[model samples]
Every structure is written in C-alpha cells, then in structure tokens.
Target: LAIAHQYVTQGGLDYAREILESALGPRKAKEILEKVQQTIRTTGFNLLENVDPKQIVNFIQKEHPQTIALLLAHMEPKNAAPIVSALPQELQVDVATRIATMESISPETLDQVEEVLVSQIKSLFGGDVSEIGGVKAVAEMLNSVDRGAEKNILGNLERENPELATEIKNLMFVFEDVLLLDDRSMQRVLKEIDTKDLSMALKGASEELQEKFFRNMSSRAAEMIREDMEFMGPIRLKDVEEVQQRIVDVIRRLEEDGEIIISGRGGDEDIVV
Candidate 1:
C-alpha cells in the first residue's frame, strides 16, 4: 500500500490501482481505486487546463466535430470555450450541436481523443466512461465564450437543430444573467431594448435584478418602468418569458457588436478604464 500510494502520488494512478487490486483484493482495492481515480481525473483536468488554447486549437482544428466535441466534453467549460471559439465557424456550430446532443462517450473514443492530446499536448486522459456533453455542457461552454462566437454557433445550430438549440439556449445566460452585467454594460443594453419589453421581462425577474436595471437608469425612467410593469398586471408566464428572451437577444446582439462588455463570465477579461 505504501509503494502503491507513492506511485499514485507520482501520477501513476492506473498502475497504483492495479497494484492495489492485486495485493488487497478487488473489494479493498476498489475503495483505494476510487480515490486514485478521482485524483487522476483532477490531474487530467488541470493538465489540460494549463495548456495554451491556441496549441489545442491548432492541433484539433482539422479533426471531426464529433472528435472535437468528445475531447472538449472532458474539459472544464472555461478551458473548453476558447477552443470552441477558435475553431473555424462552421466547426464551431457542428461541435456545439454535437456537444448539446451528446450523451456518453465510449472508452475507445476517449482514448482516441487522449491519443491526439498526448501527441500534441503531452498530456494524458485518465477517467472512466461517463455521461458527458449534454445541453448543460454546451450551455456552460457557450456561456464562457464571446457573444459573437456564441451567437454564430447558436444561429447555425438553430437552423440545423431547432429543438436542441432552444434547449441549449434555455440553459445559457437567461434574463437573470442580466444582473451579471456591469452598470455600464447594463446601461448600454437598456439603450437597445424597448421599455415595454424591459418591463415585461422584469415582471418575472427577482427584485434584485429589477433594481440592477433601475439603478442604471435615471430616476424618472426607472419609476416609469415600474409603473408600466404594475399597470400591465398579471402577465402570462409564457408572454413574460418571450419578452425576456427578446431582451436577452438584444443584449447578445449588442455584445456581439462590441457595444458592451460582460465581464467575469469567462472568455477574455477586459480591463475597464
């Protein structure tokens, strides 16, 4: 056990697990193996996370979307988003769609992706076959990407697979994410959105989010929107959601156009002067 633990600490998790199984029996080995496996996975994630995204982009650019999706599914969203954004635009959509619809990746497929990474990245992938790449994965990755890449990918995805696109979009930055925008960005977004749409959208929002928008506006304008929302009274959930989506679309468009910056969500960190 001491020798195996040494091997594990040195990143020889598979070898250590095998040694443990042989010496300690499967039942006892399993407990140790599980811990070893978790360590291996964390090591694998950190190894990839530490790599330059451009190196990864150049290495995998020519690979099939399914291959790209499978590899990215193993990475943390922050690490994966830039690679997706750097991919050729068409591949971006294809990979995003594949990731949204993907359920599980076979061990063989994982090994193949690992082989590609090992050749170019000098990194190892160590983990069991597991569920990965569903709508949430795609959403999280997209959330971390620039609005332009995110919009282009989702736009193409909408035409190719509407239902999957809607599902992924639903999981992504919702109306509530507006609260994440800085005051300057919030004011810029408000300029693009109609007051009625904003009122309707805020109807379903939390008080905090409503106040976020209100504080960014003039006192008169903020009070007017509040009055508009109250007069509208008891709007349908579906209607509120629709208007919220429209407002969210406007925010996405403005960001894509470089009119505003949404910081701390991922992607490039902007230093505002």
Candidate 2:
C-alpha cells in the first residue's frame, strides 16, 4: 500500500492522497499529493502552451493509440478536443475508448510521453518534421491575397499535394459560402462591400449564390447588377478571382468586427469568434 501510494503521488493524481487519506487518514500525505499534482499540471500545460493542435495531432498519430489516449487524458479539454476530432475517424473511437478505460499511468511513463511530445514539438520548429499545413491555414492565407495568387498557390499545392489542396479548398469560404449566411449578416456584408467588387466576385460564384444575392437586393438593384455583369464580358479569371478575394476580404473583416457571423468550415462551430 505504501508503494501504491507513492506511485499514485508521483503520478500526479491529486485523488491519490484522497484515497490514501481515506484509509490512512494522513493530512501530510494529502498536502504532498496536492503539490505534486499542481506541479505536474503546470509543467505539462506549459510544455504544450505554444504548440499548435495540428502539430500535436501529427506527433501523436505515430504513437500507439493507447499512448495517444493517455497523452490526451492529461491535456486540457480545449487542446485535446480538436486533436481528437482531427484524428482519423477509426482511431478516434479507439483512442476515446482507451482514454475512458485508462485507470492509472505510471509517473515514469507519463514523463516519457511528455518528453516525446516536447521533443517532437522542437523538431517541428527545427524543420525536422514537415511543416504543418491544414485547410484552416490555407483558407485563412488565401482570404488575405488576390484571387490570382490564391489560385496559383493552391494550384501548386494541389499539384504537389492534391489531398491538402482539396482540404484547403473545402475549408475556404468562397462566394458560395455567402449563401449559408443569415440574411441579416449577408445584408450587413453587402452594405460594406463595393458594388463593383461584388459584381466581379459574383462572376465566378455559383448560380445559387448569385440568385441569393439577387434575392437579398431590391429588384431594380438586382437587375442593375445582372446587367453590369453581362456587359462586363470576357473578364480574366485572375481579375475575377482578385475581385472575388477582395469581396471575401470584406466579408472576413465584417465577420472579424462582429458585424456579421461567418459560419465555420467542415461542419464545425466557429473556432474563433
């Protein structure tokens, strides 16, 4: 029992002392347990404080599912949730089950796991690991650039990594995403964006999105826009994309300023307000 208590305490389980005290009724043991757990929590979270969730997921994906489960069990829910969700679907169930069934991890084992994670994070920054690229990062980057640039970059990324490019495109909020916006938010964004930019942006937009925009406008205004788009024939794809990106930038700014709400990508809640 003394060895068990020592293991529990060293493992940073605050409840270890509680269990010990229940049987032994020792106050000093409880105090020591509290301190140990506090130290572990502080140190562990600090190690991951600057690490991105994607990097963590990538690092752990190479580990055993049980090991991944154990590591996540020690992490904050906020940090762990996305990593878990981002994991391959088949592994998610296995890892989640492992975490649920996990009882106790030896302190030495925990330390090893932490050391591996920390080292992996260092490797990522040291360029030992492939740079972390994700749909969210790509979409956010494209949102800031001209359409032509966005297309060129995405085209290159696609040729090199088709899967990644596809994922990024799925995450990106195109002119089509405007159709998903609430009417009020759409109106709010439309009010802020220049009509010319909107017209050019709509040139490449889906018909559904174009009609949604028309429906939101007065009939006369909608007719004027349609006429303008028709008369502005043979526009370059680059110019269309550039103007579209400009409109997207406006919507992004509106969303950022809290004037409009942009729904999240990949069927998720907005990660950032």
Candidate 3:
C-alpha cells in the first residue's frame, strides 16, 4: 500500500496500478504493487537519510480497521494475511477498538469502488494487436522460448505495467506472419497486380515466386505481361508511388529476406553512378 501510494504520486495517477491489481491473483497483485512502486520510487534518486522503519510499521498497524482490511487485501492473502493475523496483541486490540467505534460505511462508496475497478481494468488491458513491434522483436524473443515462458512474462507485465507490453505487441510483425496475410489472401492480392510490372518488380526474385504471382493473376493479363516485359523501363517517381503501393508488403518481405535494395531520398552527391 505504501508503494502503491508512491506510484500514484510519481506517475500522476492514471489508475494503472489499481487496474493491475484487479488482474492479479490475490498474491501476485500484492507483489506487483510493491515491485512497481519500488521501481517508481527508486527511478530518480539515490539513498537518503533513512526514515524510521517503526513509523512505517506503525502507520500500517494503526490505520482504521476497514482501511487496513482493504489494504491487506491489496497484499497477497498468503504473506500479508499471516502478518496481519500475527500482529502484536496491543496493535490488534487497538485496531479492534477503533473498528468498534466507527460509523457504518455507505453502500454508495462500495458501488463506486466496484465501478472504478471494472472500468479501469478494461482500459488498462485494452490494446490493438495489429501494430506490435516490427516483426523482428517478437520473433527474436520467442526463438527457442516456450509458450509457458511467454505466458508468465505477459502475466507479470500485465500486472505491473500493461501499457508498455501492449505497445510492444502492436509494433512487431515477425516474418510474413498474418502481419502480411494468410497464404490464401496472398492469392487475392496477386490478382490485383499487372503481371509485367509484377514480374519486373520481381526481377532477381525467384522463379517459384514469379510463378506464384502469375498463377494468381488473371490469365489474359498474365499473357499480356509475358509479351510486354521489354517495354517496361525504369520506374517513374509518380509511378513508383502507384507501383510501390501495389507491392509494399511484398517489398517488406523481400527486404526482410535481404534479397533487394531500395534507395531512399538523398542529395545528388549521395547517389552512386
């Protein structure tokens, strides 16, 4: 709970931690709250004059019974509950004494807290899967890694800091992974291109690949392309845009394979003969 308070103070209270807590199995959430707050508190500072540990322990021990109950629930029932159970006789008596004198909590407050937890949980975990790290990162990380290992990492990430992990997943698209299209969709896509330019764009590309493109194209257009290959010349800039739009996904695949070179905008002096 102290760590959680520190997290809110540092990160401006986007309610990320609360949402994280909701997702954790009671124990893990408690662990993550402590871990994340530790990360935030130590992020920018070195050690300073130590405050009294007794004060820290007392603050938690002497809080209102209801508040302490809620806070301990934030902790894992295993470790935290045991500590609460084993509290010094005086502290337990003090908390019970306080609880006996307290007024009843309003039902409205419980409703509000439940609503906040639900809304925040969805917001924190919500994500767009399409934009994950460039195909490179996921593939690299998963190499030789098992699904169970990945699951554990993702679960821990979701608990402590979900926003960052969601962003990582969106920015990557390892290999031709649907990232491109399923093999069936590739057939429909090849149908949309002019075979001659397709073949030329594919020049130095593989025979099997060229055939893949042609087989998917309209037969008459494929014939026209076979006859007109010679007439096609260096791609015009205006046409490059049009042409590139047609093959960008394919080019990305080719680029990934290290099979083609693509020049970029540069001054005349930077261009080689």
Candidate 4:
C-alpha cells in the first residue's frame, strides 16, 4: 500500500488516475482518462502550437458549447473571434457567453475537450499543430473580415459580453492603426499609397489620425492632402472604407515581406541580423 501510494504521488495525479481507471470501469473512468490524456498531449508535445486558426474553426463548429468555450479560452482571442463570428447565429451567443463567463474548469473537463480536438487533428494530418486564439489572433481575424461582419460580431459581443469585447477591440488594428506605425514604416506605406486613395481613405478618418499622416509627410505634401480632403466633399462611407482597407492591405503586405514593422503586433523588437 505504501509503495503504491508513493508511485501514485510520484507519477502525478494523471498516472494515478490511469491506474484507478482499470478498476473503475471505462464509463466511470472516462473523465479521469480524459484528464490524463489531455495533460499528456498538451504538456508532452506541441500538438497544436501554431496550427492555422481556420483549422480551429473547423473543430469548434462541431463541439458542444462548453467544450468550444474551453478551447477558445485556451486560444488567443484574435483566432477565436473569427470562429465566433462564423458560428451559426444561435450558437454564437451561447458559446461567447461561455467564453466570457468560463472560469476554473476542471482538468477532467478540459481533457475531454482536448481529446475531441486531438483525435480530429490526428485524423486530419497526423502531426502536431499550433495553439489557438489570443488577443493577436482575434485582431488578425478581425483585420480580414468585412466591416459589416466585424461590426456585427463586435456589437453582439458587446451586448452579450462587454468585457471580452473591450479586450478584443484593444487588440485589433483597423485603419486607424496606421497611426501606431513608426515614422519609417509609415513613410514606406505613404510612398505606396495613391493621393486619391489616401484622400478618400481619410475622408472619414479622425483628426488625430489625419494629423499623424500629415506629421509624417513633407510640409508641402501635408498641405496638398489637407486641401484634397477639404474638397473631397461628402464621400460615401463605403468608399472610404474600401480605400482604407486597400491601405491596410498594403501595410499588411509590407509587414509580411519584412519591409516594415507595425508596432504592437509583436514586431517592435530590434533584430540584430
């Protein structure tokens, strides 16, 4: 008895649970088995460390709300938001509510959730994947969606769960995120933008962002844009958004190619090489 107790304690609760399962029967040991397996998968290996967010979306769609919520909780919000937005309307609120309110889930429950994903992931490709949602993940996802879908998801989230909404918004980068770029990167982006598109994009921009753009340009160019904006009268919101999205696309491409760094998306570090 002493030796068994020592082995259980030394091996950890998971190992102990596996031993007990043999006597408890499969039905009674199901929950314990789940915890043991989940711990092994997550801690023993990076099974889903950097898997695409879309893959996560596929998995969560078929899961129970509680299970989905648990998985999302573990993921970055950026990755989770798109999944939430893409969900069938009826499930959105329920799953989101669970995310906002979920707390202190047992290892057994988490194991059960991870088990479902692990099995599906194994069947799909038979290898380790990346972790899911985070603030950055949600931000990146929002950056890709249409404005209307973005707005609706955030609106519903704000109503159903204000706290999570605020957190996600802070993480996201919209047209206004341009202001966050350092001067050099900002200038690089400016060089690629057409005057007309810039004018249209700024039609609905806040004075602060406009000032940021002006501050980054030659005085003459600033004066010219100011003049253009003043006369650009009554532009459609959709047009402004389209041009803004275009500018955002340019910035994203530049960032992807290592041409420029956008602050707060984790690229602020000084690379020695």
RMSD of each: 5.2, 15.8, 21.9, 13.9
TM-score for each predicted model, relative to the true structure: 0.68, 0.42, 0.25, 0.44
Q: For candidate 2, write residues 72-157 as lDDT tens digits.
A: 65555445656766677666545644554455455555556656666655521111111122345435544443333444555666
- Name the regions of candidate 1 deviating beyond 4 angstroms: 1-32, 115-120, 146-148, 182-207, 217-246, 253-273
**Compared to the true structure, candidate 4 yields what TM-score?**
0.44
Residue clash pairs of candidate 2 = none
Kindly indicate the candidate among 2 and 3 with the higher TM-score: 2
Candidate whose lDDT is highest: 1
Order of the predicted models by TM-score, top scorer first = 1, 4, 2, 3
lDDT of each: 0.80, 0.63, 0.42, 0.66
Better of 2 and 4 by TM-score: 4
**Ordered list by lDDT, greatest first:** 1, 4, 2, 3
Q: Model 4 segments beyond 4 Å from truth?
A: 1-69, 73-137, 140-172, 267-270
Error of 1 at 145 (Å): 3.4
How many Å off is the CA of 261 in candidate 3? 27
Model 2, residue 114: distance off in Å is 18
User: Could you tell me the lDDT of residue 265 within candidate 3?
Assistant: 9
TM-score computed on alpha carbons, candidate 3: 0.25
